[model samples]
Target: MEHLKTFLLKRFRIKDLGDLKYFLGIEFSRSKKGIFMSQRKYALDILQDSGLLGACLDNFPMEQNLKLTPTDGALLHDPTKYRRLVGRLIYLTVTRPDIAYSVRTLSEFMHQPRKPHWDTALRILKYVKGTPGQGLLFPASNNLALKAFCDSDWGGCRATRRSVTGYCVFLGNALISWKSKKQTNVSRSSAEAEYRAMANTCLELTWLRYILQDLKVLQTVPVPLFCDNQAALYIAANPVFHERTKHIEIDCHIVREKLQAGMISPSYVPTRFQLADVFTKALGKDQFVTLRDKLGLHDIHSPT
Candidate 1:
């Protein structure tokens, strides 16, 4: 970059900003082990705006086994406020992926937020308040392997009866991408939901491989994708689809094609080791913290 800057300066004028410290509401810093990224100021502002800056903290964003129904809560007086606040929190998820599941849950009621829904959103803000400085850490290393975990909650949404798909991709030990989204179509079975989530993850892995290729980084090994559902693994590895799986025919084929092509290797993981579960559903505080830590996120100021 320095050499290119010199050559470009000879032809035209440009300014140098040195190394990046902060940009687009995200703070950046370096440590002996790795690079740290956080949205501390942005998160604090959200708490302050919601009058939760001094509020007691919540160890987890949402309650364990928490369920929300559109018809359950009292109608909010101002729907616009709920929309705006949820929008801001969505942006914060760029660095705070730990809150992705909760934000996705809250965003569902944007059209007509109820008092209960707004209360749940406030709970997320409180969770953010407790760990504003916690964020991703990308360590400097030679491990460039691309691996991922894919999981889903079968019909977690009551009103829509739609499954939630979640996956996280890791380049070595650093998390590069993750998503928690409601499937457009309703799945008839848990295996079907898991199969669809695996298909989504396979496509994402393929795209990331192409991006790495564009940067001249070659991935020689087949990407390994871990799924907790044994039935889903069997479906991916099997080419034969039966009566029950007819509902998920397309997804089954997509995953099978990827597996046959050696683009991705599907493996079984136990529920306790499934990192993507945190993204797929509301979790207890103990479980949330364990997986969040596994994502390589920690407070930058905390003692090692």
Candidate 2:
């Protein structure tokens, strides 16, 4: 990586190693095309543990635009099963970004899972059962461009009236990080929620830049952060203080600072192409597949 050379020139000395085969349960393979990482063995073990190794494959991870509420189901007599599945799903999200939101939704009910929560958790397991070989594909490229996508669903959590936020970071076309979670406080408007999500995304971007720098990979250009909300982009580009925008947090201002310093820039993207949408809520089969492909996830065994 040219970036790595650029970064390493200033930092600690380093040595080149040969191709990587495995690390931390994730296996890697390299060819002229690119490097591939997957947790096939781990996925299979999880399915076998849950007794769904031979189950039929699911067409989608979750129901189309599925919504889960805090009070929608009866309390479970035992929560041990639900908790175990949730824990595994969390780790799986490291490679299966498609199920991040659903896993986050299920984890919320860990304290006192209900029937519906348990059912949803099982649905996720069933989905995982079918795709043990699916993983991220990092095609060989000349550049490791950094970019981010962020999205939020206003008042998505029915119980708290708090919005759900999600974002994904990509190095070149390969996904490196992502998240799906709820906002701490209720946002008065959709723009406010979008702003908060952008701020979170900004923090992630900042940290990632540092990591790459530490690894001797330096980004040559400003990271473009994509969002579906125009208001959020406007707020990031402007620097006016108003009472109505007082709730706008200090963290949110970091976006402007990054922009001004040529570290990061905010850009608008259509909701249809917003990759982070997958992390904010469930979607229909067609849309989900589209975003998943965009994120560079494909079945390694599939004939290309």
Candidate 3:
């Protein structure tokens, strides 16, 4: 580290910051157990800017089974505020995967936000207020094996009827990457949706493996990819193709190819233990809390 610093110092004038305490809007704190990250100040600033600092707090970001259509309610008089707030919330999701689904849903309405959509967006703020210091924790561990969970909500979007794909990848116990997104094409069945999600997860895993290889982190064993759908697992393992899966032939090929190459091993995980469920849809408080803990999110400000 000193050799590189000396080389850079000789050519360009630079000052050592010593260690990364904060960058952009993220706050970092370290201990023997692990490094903790949060956006507490950023979150509080957002609440103050939106006049939600004193609003009633919410235990969870969104209601379970809540559906928001494009034409649900009257359009907002000034959508600029809605757009800006949702945009900031989108950035906040970088360290707060707990709110990913809510923010993703709100982002869809940015083009034509309705009153109800604005209200739902504010509800997210209220939830943020409850734990502004909540963030990801990278625990100190020697294990670096990659594990992943992927899920799909078949036809989750009420307006477009598009399935939502959600997946989270962990290096050891630390969450490295996650996403909640709507599929571009409509799926004919739940298995197809799950298969598409597996394909997307496979792509992410493949990229991460390359990154690890560059960092000299050798992966001797194939990474485990957990999915709740048995049919999807069977599809990945099965070599024969059928008419039912013809539409998603490309997606099947992507996952099956990786499986055949021993890059990723697809397995079944029960819905209750599926941590990716929180990203796919709005969950109840109990289930949300359960999965949120499993995601390695910690509130540093909370009493021990």
**What would you estimate as the lDDT of candidate 1?**
0.90
- Report RMSD for candidate 1: 1.3
Tens-digit per-residue lDDT, 172-275, candidate 3: 99999999999999898999999999999999999999999999998889999999999999899999999888999999899989998999988899999998
Poorest 10 consecutive residues of model 3 by lDDT? 136-145
Query: Which candidate leads the pack in TM-score?
Result: 3
* Model 3 local distance difference test score: 0.94
Count clashing pairs, candidate 2.
1
**How does residue 5 of candidate 2 score in lDDT?**
71
Candidate 3: clashing residue pairs, number:
0
- lDDT against the true structure, per candidate, is 0.90, 0.85, 0.94
Cα lDDT of model 1 by residue, 1-304, tens digit: 8899899889987777887899999999986887889988888888888888889989999999899988896899989999999999999999988889999999998888999889889999988888998888898774988999999999999988999999999999999999999999989889989989999999899999999999988888889899999988888777777898888888888888878888898888999899999999999989899999898887976668
Name the runs in model 2 displaced over 4 angstroms.
1-19
- Tell me the deviation in Å of residue 55 in model 2: 2.6
Score candidate 2 by TM-score against the native.
Answer: 0.89
How many steric overlaps does candidate 1 have?
0
lDDT of 2 by residue, 80-185 (tens): 9778878987888877888899999888888888887887777777777767778888888747889999999999877888999999999888899999999998
* Candidate maximizing lDDT: 3
